[model samples]
Target: MSKTDHPHTHQTHAAIIKRLKRAEGHLRSIVAMIENERACVDIAQQLHAVEKAVCQAKRTLIQDHIDHCLEDSVGALGRGERVPLDEFKQITKYL
Candidate 1:
């Protein structure tokens, strides 16, 4: 079953939100810096920080989904049924 088929909560949700909010704030400041004609180096640094924050948030979200949702998807399968577990590793390859 898909995650959308059921309602559930994730422990990492709050932390992800916090990270996104911080990235949003950094993005806003980056915009202001551009409007103020800040140096390219300074703007690039802020952009890097925002990018890293967003990437980290995404990684945390995906990992949480793998940890919880995948387990739910797999249910009580036999030990030899390792495809879903293999998918857990495959999903992280994108990160």
Candidate 2:
């Protein structure tokens, strides 16, 4: 489903996008460093930073989806309704 169709909005969408962009820039710099024959330690450090940023962005997005979309969807269910255990397990895999 599209973001607009989700029951809850992502408050960190903008921040996530910003983080991804920064990661993208970092990746480009790493590529340039490789072409310029930069020191291995410097390249590794930059690569590490890029990986960490991308990881953080992914984590933030997943947490936002769980906290908002999943919670909101389940909260809307009628009193007698039940969410499948398998579905809960599936969602938790992202965490």
Candidate 3:
């Protein structure tokens, strides 16, 4: 079934939002640091933190979507059908 037909909420939605917000804060600080002519190493460290936070948030959100969609729609893991190998690979590209 299409997503619209099986509408459901992610269990990790709140945690994901929190992570994104933290990343946003780091990004804004990075901008301010640039404006203040901070050291390159310091700025790079903060940038790395932002990158990790965003990556983690994206991974969590996508994994949650995959898990819930499979379970709710296709009877994944516990049932006979599993998420298609191609579909799983497609999503992993982003991660």
Top candidate (lDDT): 1
Over the stretch 2-46, how does candidate 1's per-residue lDDT look in tens digits? Answer: 633446679999999999999999999999999999999999999
Whole-structure CA lDDT of model 3: 0.78
Model 1 deviation from native, Cα RMSD in Å? 3.6
**CA lDDT scores, all candidates in order:** 0.83, 0.77, 0.78
lDDT of 2: 0.77
After TM-score superposition, what is the CA distance of residue 8 in candidate 3 from its true location, in Å? 3.5
Which stretches of candidate 1 lie above 4 Å from their native place?
1-6, 76-94
**lDDT for residue 55 in candidate 3, whole number 0-100:** 84
TM-score ranking from best candidate downward: 1, 2, 3
Candidate 2 Cα outliers beyond 4 Å, as residue runs: 1-9, 76-88
Q: In angstroms, how far off is 65's CA in candidate 3?
A: 1.3
Q: What's model 3's lDDT at 85?
A: 42
Query: What TM-score, to 2 decimals, does candidate 3 have?
Result: 0.73
Clashes of each: 0, 0, 0
